[model samples]
Target: MILADIPIPDLELEAHDGIDVPHDLVALSEPLEPGQMLLLRTLDGVHRCAEVVGLDFTENETIYRLTYGAPMAPEIAAAVARPPRSALRHWVDDIDVEVLLGELADAARRTATTSQAAAPESSW
Candidate 1:
């Protein structure tokens, strides 16, 4: 399935402070599967790119194993130089895939623009 086409419901992130950071707080119509890419907003509001690697189900809840990619956006890079040593494991309900692709695309455009502006002009 096209990742962009997938409908995303509101999600919450499990914060280190024990507070659940809600993405949108809306109910999900469909469930997210492994291998889907998503953008996660850290507690400080930095957006990180990630991929769902696996899922673990306990008697009570389901935890998702996410492998984060190196931050491409400057803001994200400044927030966290690297993903946590342990794989990002969060409850499935804590993730939101909505508009993730659009955000990434926008970040890419911004990076490209910045690079072009910094490049030296050719004399020719």
Candidate 2:
């Protein structure tokens, strides 16, 4: 099994659908396999978990493709990044986590179907 311990300054989901970490850039040993687990740890203690959907091997590096939900909703990210706060009628409460999550999953599924029909994205 491939093992990786990634540490990042920040976890950026937007601007790039999936991240490309040079095999030398992180504590990555061995090539990753499809369906393997990927754990991303951000500087602010915000951790995102994902499963490896694809793997590209370069001369000396491996690129992991791990998301269909390219850019997560800013609101969801913001809420998860904050420290727990018990406030009345807070913005966090206003967010319907379930609905937002359902929509996100559906959108991701659609995107995946469409993308699969097109040429595969280059993994640099």
Against the reference, the lDDT scores of all candidates come to 0.47, 0.56
Q: What is the lDDT of residue 77 in candidate 1?
A: 46
What's the CA error at residue 89 for candidate 1, in Å?
A: 33
Backbone clash count, each prediction separately:
0, 0
For residue 9, model 1's alpha carbon misses the true position, in angstroms, by: 22
Error of 1 at 37 (Å): 1.0
**77-107 per-residue lDDT for model 2 (tens digits):** 4444444455465564445667557766776
Supply candidate 1's per-residue lDDT for 25.
28
TM-score of 2: 0.41
103, model 2: CA deviation in Å?
A: 27
Work out the TM-score per prediction. Answer: 0.39, 0.41
How far out, in Å, is residue 61 in model 1? Answer: 0.2
